[model samples]
Target chain A: MMPGSLRAACVAVLRRDLLLAWRRRGDIALPVLYALIVTTLFPFALGPNDDLLARVAGGVVLVTVLLAMLLAFDALFRPDLEDGSLEQLMLAPQPLALLLGMKILAHWVSTALPLIVIAPILASMLHLPAHANAVLVLALLVATPLLSLLGSVLVALTAGTRRSGMLLALMLLPLCVPVVIFAAGAVSAAQEGLPWIAPIAWLGAALALMLILAPLACAAALRIAIDA
Target chain B: MTAENSPSALLAARDLTFLRQDEPVFGPLDFALRAGEVVLVEGDNGSGKTTLMRVVVGLLHADEGTLYLDGAPLDRDLARGRLLFLAHHLGLKADLSPLENLRIAIGLYGCREAITPQQALHTVGLQGYEHEPVRQLSAGQKKRSALARLLLVPADIWLLDEPFANLDREGIALVNRLIERHVAEGGAAMVTSHGAVTFLHGEPRRLRLSA
Candidate 1:
């Protein structure tokens, strides 16, 4: 059994990662800035048709946030792997999955939390209706953690490989389809004045399932990467 | 030191064999480490010395063998708290100061005797440079920073890979002194080094792996 309390270990890992991310504020801002820029470009690309922008805004924002998350995912384990901190983590008395889960939580806080905070502004800029705004935020709230969890598995799998960014994207995109579909479906339902709760619930369910399975899978993949 | 001179083996490997890509890398090796002892793994370049340490640390799985900790089959959860492995990589983040790094390290795998990060840095001769980013430190300093974990963390077994590399004469002597103190205090250390290490306490037992 692990020596210390699991809660304490998880908290320590989470706090340490957050502090490290705080020190490198510029790196934390990259994904949020990327999301903002990507959201802003949609209006120009589709010629400022408010209806068109609103119609696509839900899907567009989810896609851009995912893309931004992808940018952050590639570096999730890279720094730890390069600097040998990952090996120490493996040696921790706590379970590797627990530690990895904490890292994923910190990633969401640093990368996705800001995006969630700014998402309403992006929604308004896209002419998304006020009714759908709450649904949009809710969908993203459930979906981003799922994305971080799933993305962590992929990142762990590709942790030690050279030039893994493109490889990570390829491995992650197909797995992310369900999140995108469910998240966008919820917003689309809200846009059409239909009940949006079902899709959001589905997103939550997927997040729950991933919460159980992803950390263990990511830990196994991390072992493989380190051994390789 | 209550367990000093105890014959009971703290760590043991039986017929331990590891393979890479369907071929045996190192094979069917047997060794035992007891409390209050130091074992130097003597091997030439690419003789799987590092791999052996990695296997012991659970970073790599053994293809054909059993490892025992305290006479039972090794379980990672139990082994982790009792074992500390310092691999070839120093494991220090370049962006973080030595103090920050030590705090995280101690928080994750706690020490038996609680000592602050500052004290650990001072123990490693990094007193004045506690707040400087590790990237700014020389190779020897970085290695010393990593070595501080041995002092700060509480573990019975130490698997050190090239602990003497990149150290000045004084730094090498420092490592020797630390290992001597650790072994004398009922801890066992297994170290792999290209250069000969002159132990301050006594000569370390040898385990040679041939490629």
Candidate 2:
């Protein structure tokens, strides 16, 4: 934990980030909508069989949430880095790790929080088994922040590049595989009436690992982005 | 911690070199800035005026050489605490109100004894416009809003790249006063600008870079 002053600064950044997401509603809302629409389309694209839907629902919700997280990743720091807010942020006395954490925190609140709240509803639309749906939302609540935190680093890495969004997806999609596998696996295991604890524990561990390392990576990448 | 009472250069750089996109930007250079002194970095576009400041401020490390702040070797985090950088881009969050921006900035910097929003706004000549989103402000007004952070935080060194490029006469005057006030408070500043600013209390030594 940082001193109160630095913590306050991080909180300030988090607040501003959340407020901006509120003001632009569409930036964050669109991704949640994308997740919902994509999840809903699975039944139509495949078939109306409840048994098939139950088996596929976990993967559908997990994949859609992953895509939704990526969609909003661009908003993390590129604008601030390009427009000079990054320089101000770098110049501030607060540690870059803490400052980056604040942005990641903000991103989770706006993007992941909504996804968690809405995952249950989307799961029902997919005809997911009730037990599996609970596991799906729970896994997401634990896993989505990991995606945002790690994805933010990749976003920072490609910050000033010509094809940043494409580059970010290329770099990040691979790293996100574990999260997808573990989170979706948890729900799938629940659907099969197997204990889902192993995958859930893995997801929790991955989230903790990401929480520790992602801020440092994002801060270093931000320095590169600004220099470039 | 390096004691302030010791006779030392607040900022010192030796043979600093920076490379951008495989092209040498500036340096293999040396310089020092002491308390209350001002240093002027002069160069045309793409000549690395911004790059040099970035390196000095420890946002970008030099390809060669070493930097020192307050008699200690400069690290990114330590240097960040000692220096303030204002870049050519205004860095304003267009969607955020001016007060929101300043308060957020102060928060991000972890400035204790940070000024109230009213004081920061008044200092930047933005008194009545605190609640308006920065995007709604004019170019000069936006710049002022960006600069409002200076009043909210206490920094030992100021690195400004083109502090007056897009300002009106009044804005320029305001910038001058701000710089003068910063110096009066025993702080040092390094800046790059297009032309002479007559209002700086002391003549800053000029260093020019050629592409």
Candidate 3:
């Protein structure tokens, strides 16, 4: 019996979550499908005007991705909390924050990565500029993770409570305002032929901060959830 | 457990009581468990048996009183990797197989000196269902899968809320055998049940909780 190290624990948890996500491959597709349907409707709703679609394309993709991410938020920690796996995770010897960080990483990879991969396609479908496509993807690359990290803390707080799906949306959407602003700001700036680096840099700074703090908040919130 | 440590009580409780909504759930209780000892916690329904077990494992903080491990105050940091808890929830992932579940536990708590996940599953009577998803297993088999975790983890203290629940006669005997082997190896355990267990090693100490 080899003693498990902190690194081993992290790897094990990451692999476990990824494997579970892979097994439930259909669940991973729901958000992508949701994003696909939502992006497809923008043209039909407001007429197929290229200017209108192009103007709204950056904002549309950002909000669509954010909302798509929200669709999968319930899967973040609720299942683990209900099945007692979260309790086991808390009881592990390693720092709870580190383990949760791993979980958050897996969540971003499975849920948001797919949406990001399809983002340019989704944006281009709305007539978003070809030159602005890189900026859109780059902004999403930073913004999606920030949303995931922030959403994890809210998910942790609402765990173990019934009817949390709506509550999660109500609470998370307000907090998502800033993330959406910076991300959409970057994309729009790029489309308007302006320097878009500042907003993306802001998103990066916030991501760095949340990447450190959100997991610690999740650890504390979940301990309280389990305690109660 | 580190070497060169002095012999002392593995676990001790002093006026340890838990309250819910300002109502007393359990004691103001006192107890101590030494190495190689098993304390049988006997209580009636809603008599704080599970509550006591949760407090012992630090899942729920005591409303009033202190708990000590190896003669030092029990805190979250110290209690982790040292205490193993198996309550009503087996804590296994339904989507993963028993083997994968055991591997996750091992990854968290580290393995015991000489046991592998496969060996632990075999010890717990889950030899043939190593890769079967835990959701497909029956209630007793799920419990057995959790029991495999007890074999693989290296924690020194075991707090089993109800080891006999949802088990057949052979499963009960299997649990007793595991406890006996665990105790003989100088590990301490506190088990709660409805007084149906008959130990093979003569008799164990009983800690009764009164409502």
Q: Every model's Cα RMSD, please? A: 3.0, 3.2, 2.9
Residue A80 in model 3: lDDT: 85
TM-score, prediction 2:
0.92
Clashing pairs in 3: none
- List TM-scores for all candidates, in order: 0.94, 0.92, 0.96
Residue A191 of model 1, lDDT score: 95
TM-score of chain A of each: 0.96, 0.94, 0.97
| Clashing pairs for predicted structure model 1, backbone only | none
Error of 1 at A180 (Å): 1.1
What tens digits encode model 1's per-residue C-alpha lDDT throughout B130-202? 9999999999999999999888888889998988888888888889888988988989999886534533346
Query: lDDT by residue for model 2 over B1-211, one digit each (tens)?
Result: 2332235678887778998776789977777787877888877777888889877877676888888777677776566666778887877889988988877766665443645768878988898999998888998899998788777666778888788877888888888888888888898888786544434445776677766
- By DockQ, is 1 or 3 better? 3
In candidate 3, stretches whose alpha carbon ends up further than 4 angstroms from where it belongs are: B1-7, B195-201
| TM-score, ranked from best to worst | 3, 1, 2
State in Å the error of residue A188, model 1.
1.3
Against the native complex, each candidate's DockQ, computed on alpha carbons, is 0.53, 0.56, 0.68
Show the lowest summed lDDT stretch of 10 residues, model 2 chain B: B1-10
